[model samples]
Target: MEHDYYKEYYELERNHWWFVAREGILSNYIHRLIEQGKLSSKDLKILNVGCGPGRSSEYLSKFGKVTSIEYDEFCCEFASKKTGLEIINGSITELPFEDNSFDLVCAFDVVEHVEDDQLAVKELKRVTKKGAFVLITVPAFMDLWSHHDVINHHFKRYKIKEVNLLFDTINDGNKVFDTYFNSLLFLPIYFFRKVSNFLKLGQKRKGSGSDFEAFKPGVLNRILYKIMYFESSVINRKIRFPFGVSILYNWKKF
Candidate 1:
């Protein structure tokens, strides 16, 4: 990822509709697990892999102890300062931790950035205790690939089956919940990306910016956040959408 993009991301993550809504969705899932007696908030040990600017790590801290790791040194420093947590400089494919270490592990929008995504997933599972939860989120569909993916240095988007297959590699892992989210705006986002590609916008500029750069906080932002937040409520009921802009998977190592 470009340096400037990281700076932009740090600034926008707090209030951006995408970040805010995504966090809400993830939080809903965690809260649901606690409600089901599958997880306990007290004394939970969480490993937040690829914790970019540490917002998610900070949020995860509310549940229990959070160990954050980031590949970029700059992001490690930035996140450490922002969250006041000791951020480890590390790679997901080669996590610096003992086997079966964490009660809960998360790698949101991280695996796609790795060239060897399988190794990343394996490492994630390796450090997670038996019967512990692993939560992952990734961009959905190769067809949805756009400047947003490119600027973010993504390897590829995923189909539901593909994501399932990735987790299936771990014989001991059972998928407890999975869904495609950001569904409400998929059509509009797809159309916008198509039009932007046709216009050759940002095509010539590699390492320029991301889709988030175009977003400005306003009524529309608030509306989108509310829409996704409602979608999250449906997801908490284990209701699944047929398709969406991103995929979320919740797995338990057994």
Candidate 2:
């Protein structure tokens, strides 16, 4: 992401509906797997790759022990202090863990920022045990590419087919167990991105505050959160959404 976006992330993730809903959805997915006997909390050893500031550790802690790995030292420091969890400052391209070390590995919105996404996925697979689950989320569609991607220094956004292919190759031929287009708020966000790109808004890329210039009101925020909550419920039921501003998936290691 952009240099100072961590501060923005810290704030937004704490209060933003987008972050809240996404985390809820991911939590639902994890617990669902647990319910199906696919994952056992007693034997769980989780690796949160690229876990920024460890904002997710609270929910993740419900499953089992959590180990956070971040490429940035600043983020590691912040996350460690905030979450009080084990935080490793390291790169995802080369995870400093043994083969099949983790029962679950989750990478949230991290791959798009990686230069070698394929290598990163391979590293993720290398660290996860056979039949373990890997949950991930990434920005979707090149058309949604705008100052957000630019400010965040994203290497690229992904389509459903593209991300699926990337994971399939690294997952030992195992297909993604469940994949869905997320962000039920996609239409509004799409239009916002289109307008921003068309008008060259924030194209020059300033500092950290550019992202919050358009923050919504409290009531609207709650309303959007509710909508996403319902959509996430739909996803929890295994109904794959056709499109969204982002993609979320769970893959089982073969």
CA deviation > 4 Å runs, candidate 1: 203-208
Clashes of each: 0, 0
Question: What would the per-residue lDDT of candidate 1 be over residues 1-254, giving only the tens digit for each residue?
Answer: 76566667876778889999999999888988998989986899999999998788878887889999999998888767766889999999999899999999999999999999988999999999998999999999998888778878999999889989988984788999889999999999899888777876656544355677556799989998898778988999999989999999999999
Candidate 2 off by > 4 Å: 170-173, 203-213
Cα distance off (Å), candidate 1, residue 4: 2.1
Q: Which candidate achieves the best TM-score against the true structure?
A: 1
Candidate 1, pairs of clashing residues:
none
Tell me the deviation in Å of residue 116 in model 2. Answer: 0.9
The estimated TM-scores of all candidates read 0.96, 0.92
lDDT of 1: 0.88
